[model samples]
Target: MTMGTAGLETQPSATTYELGDLVAQAWSGKVHVPHFQRDFRWTTKDVLRLFDSIVKGYPIGNLLLWVRRTPERSFTLGSLRIDAPAYEEAFWVVDGQQRITSLANALHPEGHLHDPFAVYYDLAERKFISQPKTREPQHVALPILFDLKRLLAWFRTEGEAVLHLFDEADRVATALRQYKVPAYLVRQDDLDVLTDIFDRMNNYGKRLNRAEIFSALYAGPEDGAEERLNLSRIADRLASRTGFGTIDTDTILASILARRGPDPARDIRNEFTSAGRRTAPEFENEDQDTAYAEGEEALVRAISFLQNEAGVPHLSLLAYRALLVVLTRFFAHFPAPEANTLRLLRRLYWRVAVSGPAVFKGSFTQVSRVLCARIRKGDEHGSVRGLMDTMAEAPRSLPTVERFRTNEAAAKIILSAWWSLRPRSLMTGEPYDAQDLSTLLGDQKTAATAAHVIFPRGLTAQQQLYAGNRIFLPTATDPVSEIPVMLMRQPIDLDDRTWDAVLASHVMNREATGLLADGDREGFLHIRQELIAGQLSDFLDRMAEWDYEDTPSLETLDFDNLDELEGGDDHSL
Candidate 1:
């Protein structure tokens, strides 16, 4: 009997029975079975919960079975074997794989069922083991058996007179053979109905990908059309390699886009959308499909190169995000960046992955800006290599004065090169372009650099200090506030006049051109304020973006001892 929507009389009819009875009847071939269904995959918990429901007399659910009677319709049930006489030649199960598997294990003889050990019990620990066999390998549970000898022995001894209660089991089993499990039994001739029904059912718990639903709907023939060809290939590959039996491409795409942590195989269903009717939708457009395909392909390629070519050990979300951005840029601009570009990209990639995503986003934009500057500006004084060498350790610990110096060095080298080439400030975003670089680098050119003006731009410590000290000199307790304070405990033996020049240079390099309006001094201070504010805001945005729980403090990080591994290693996988 096809339990079509019209055939299903929704009069709130109720039936009560233990799962064991249903399994016995289904096994006996007295039920309708869907040809496309797989066998029971119920975990121990699922089994236990079924038993608990029976013990507590709770309503489990209706059993959905398909009624058929053709030898051609019989399919090899997964992890199950029928030993008893055939109850029905064509009957197969449509739903309740877990429930049926559980009941079989609880009542059948050990070693008689396909998977003899279906449930696990930890003898030493005296507790039921958890799901995912890895968590409880030492445990042993029940097995499905149909040996009449064993059943008789059990009834005579362990089962006792209580075994007579099976009359009730038979009654329930008989009823289930006729009861509907609330499914639409489709015919080979009506695939559209099956496709629609499958999509609706699948989208209920989590959203399915447009590609996936399309694949499932049109999966009947393997003759590949270009549009549907890749979908099946990808789906088949993912299912074979990953065993994500109940998921589709949409879930995978969402995971790639938003999931955190080091495990690429981690579930990302909840990351993209909430649980509701909106979870499953037919993919909206060609552009989105293209983006998803491109993104997945890019990620796959990155993992392949990092793991196989570069020998990187571990893949982290931080590194992946940065790499994604870099790849996106490459795909957009260079189309095919050089191997050297990949090497440089990898150098920074590992740094971010190990540092975690929160730190990566916080530092990436500034780092990218610094990188662009260096590439634009040639190494006139061997500063570019020196900067990369020094900044290598910045990813391990919080930013410190020394690390900041490295950043400053890179900035100086890059900015100098940029200015040397395009003398116009990228920061000011002004349209004015200068023709001569010499005019900017003329004698006493950096006498008003942003750094010189920005460092301790206010009045000297001695000027506001103790009753007798000079305005520029450090008092006994206030040495930290002196000009030498910026020297980081290093003594500068320069005369007052030279000290003034040094301060001026620092301010000139770091100061914004906007701050130069009322003379270099005020402009220097104003630029420092702008840079500091901008950096701080970017940092906060990273924290929010990563959803970091604890704010990480800035300190010097040691990249040397980070157990760093390259991209080509198997560990990268």
Candidate 2:
């Protein structure tokens, strides 16, 4: 039965079909997945959910197909190797590629060999599960059971042993054949009109990222000059070379605009569009080859500074991407800074990290523009000083123990700053290696395992549980005996001697531990905040003093051992 397009001036004919029929048509070379469609990206879980929805009778959404009168090319569907007819007219899916591909792979037994969509019916749970090849008696492979002859053979031989589960199997088989998918079939001949319809339909509720949009805009005809400007390829190459996980295309685009355009804050959507290029001549004449080269070099320099100087060796540890944008502009403007200027820049970097810049509202365009202007004028000191001053005024106040739990950026900054101290694990008396921390920092889950609460959350009041109360400890070490069970456990039932032993271990500063031992939770958090603030101040001060002649070392900052607590005022607590 034919249907009509929704919400359009000129309607196109549409149709509907049972899912089983759709899969049958796909296998027999009647329906084709178009070449322009993206690769199948649905995960195993997504596929499983689709089947579950079908069984539960939930609407799986509509499919848009172009009724091609004459096929222009040949393409494969899902992971299936079956040949689609190249010369015959067929229905080409414009929307619902994901759903159609998933249906084809799961319902057709031959489709499973080419794809990773192996699914099973859990006899006990009565749900679909994607399971690896196993001899478990309860799991009935969907492809095998969906075939009527195979299901009958299985019942004749071994079905009686689990005959009770056959009801669920029959239910699933019946649903698979009866489930109907709504479809639309358009007979449009204009390729451009079809492309526009496809894009508008896909982008209705969910918007694509700037990178994806820019990639589409910059992409050229099969053989055109704009093909070389593919933003996605450029970003991927940069990520591979620098070991920075997925350098975002928007970040790269922002750097290019900062270097070549009059205003870095121009509407990026318009800037990259055809109309934008025609209206703004700067985009046409700008040397993208040189801009990309300079941007890459500047990014390398900025990453180097973060790793070697700021103790932030991994991109994941960075609190904001805006910082990178600002740094890229700075480095691009001044490829090399004086030794003193470099020191000051380091302070500014950490300062912004610890206290997230408030000006990140508009992708940091204004802040980046101001800093670029200063750097262009050769006033490096003024640029850094002015930037820091603006950051200080950001809505976020100085970090407190409570803020640590809520603000992820603040927690990361505190953790990184504390790690800079190189505190030895109380159980082993050996310093934690920076390299180990760097590797762990690559992912948040792994990084969290690097630190454990000194006082277990269950033992402390909600207010006492903050950054100050946590201590960094390696989860595992070579000497198994070096692992501290006390730190890992709650302090609730431990005896006085055990408590004193833990306190004396000095995992944190002496003052903070003394307050904890005395059960002064308020005093402990207060003193801990001061100590963290003081360390941040002291570290930045030392960084600002660095000169090319005699570069100041981390040792000079006295972070190896907690010899001098920066804010050790007793009355403050």
Cα-based lDDT at residue 319, candidate 1: 25
Report per-prediction Cα RMSD to one decimal. 23.5, 11.2
TM-score of 1: 0.38
lDDT of each: 0.36, 0.61
TM-score, predicted candidate 2 vs. hidden true structure:
0.68
Error of 1 at 283 (Å): 16
Model 1 C-alpha lDDT per residue in residues 1-573, reported as the tens digit of each score: 123453222322244443445556645545432322322455556666665455444666644433333332232233445443444333334345455555554544432243432443333343333333463333333331133344345446545544544443333333323333332232232444444455555556444444444345444421233344234345345333322222234434332332121222223332223343223322223233453465455445544444433332122102233344333323322334445444444444444433443542455444432332332122212222332342454444322111122123222222222222222212121221221222222222121222221234454543222111111110122233433334322124555454434333222232343334335543444454344334423432332223222211222234554535433365757
What's the distance in Å from true for residue 18, model 2?
A: 3.9
Per-candidate TM equals: 0.38, 0.68
Candidate 2 lDDT tens digits, 84-198 = 5554557778788788888888777767655457777787788888875664666777776677777767766656567777878787888888788889888776665676676
